[model samples]
Target: MIEGRVWKYGDDVNTDVIFPGKYTYQPLEPAEMAEHAMENLDSSFAKEVKKGDVIVAGYNFGCGSSREQAATCLKAAGIAAVIAKSFSRIFFRNAINNGLPVIELEDGVDDMEKGDTVSIDFEAGTVTHKGNAYHFPALPKEVLAILNDGGLIPHVRKQLGRE
Candidate 1:
């Protein structure tokens, strides 16, 4: 179960607002990037987010530049998963490749409000909040394999008996 205080955002929450373009020149360190995550949008996000917290957004979350930092920062920031109405193709793949679980909810994240305690059952593809159950498409086993092992590299290492 993935549970935390819900951080709600509207549609088209792009990467620039996510990681910010001003810091694009900086080193691609997860910690550094995380410190600036949502700085361009929600000023207190980086400082306030808790481990296992879920990012609930509208359509096309991560809809800007295809920088992998956008995904890595969120992962490093301790976001358990990103549940959105839709995601940009590249962002979605980057997130999966980096071990950040991203969920696409057709019904939108309307039932939950910011600061509301929310929980998601990834295996069951259901989100529960205040007795409300929101269903999302179940992630494929292959995708879960990567996330389970904490991203692709670790999973590959495990498969090859190297880690």
Candidate 2:
């Protein structure tokens, strides 16, 4: 079971705002880079976010650029997961590679409110909020394995060790 504080956002939260184009060439340090995450959408986002909070947003989340820093900043900001109606392909892959779970729910944003407590059952692919259950498409086995091992790199390392 994954439980956390919920932070709500609207649609089209692109990558430029997530990591900001200006900061992309700098460094990959999450703590410092996190300062710019969502600055265009909400300047106070980094400060307002609490550890273990989940980001609930509308469709097309993370839709610009291919920088993994956007995912890095969110994880470094201590976001447990992101629940969105849809996600950009690259961002989705980056999130999984970085050990951050992203759940694509058809109507997830509609049922979630800012600051609401949310619980997610990964194995069952269900999200529970205010006594309501929302179902999401199950992740593939390979994707689940990446998340289970704390991202792709660590999973590869573990596999090598076993071999």
lDDT of 2 by residue, 1-163 (tens): 8999998988888998788888889856788877777777888788898889999998999998999998989998889999999999999999999999999997556878988999999989899999888989889998999999998889999989953
Regions of model 2 farther than 4 Å from truth: none
* Poorest stretch of ten by lDDT in candidate 2: 27-36
Q: Where is model 1 poorest over a 10-residue stretch in terms of lDDT?
A: 105-114
- The residue-by-residue lDDT of candidate 1 on 19-128, one tens digit each, is 88878877767988899888889998999998988999988999989988899999999998888999999899889889998999957487667898888887788988
lDDT winner? 2
lDDT value for candidate 2?
A: 0.89
Which clashing pairs does model 1 show? none
Q: How far does residue 72 in candidate 2 sit from its true spot (Å)?
A: 0.5
What are the lDDT scores of the predictions, listed in order? 0.87, 0.89
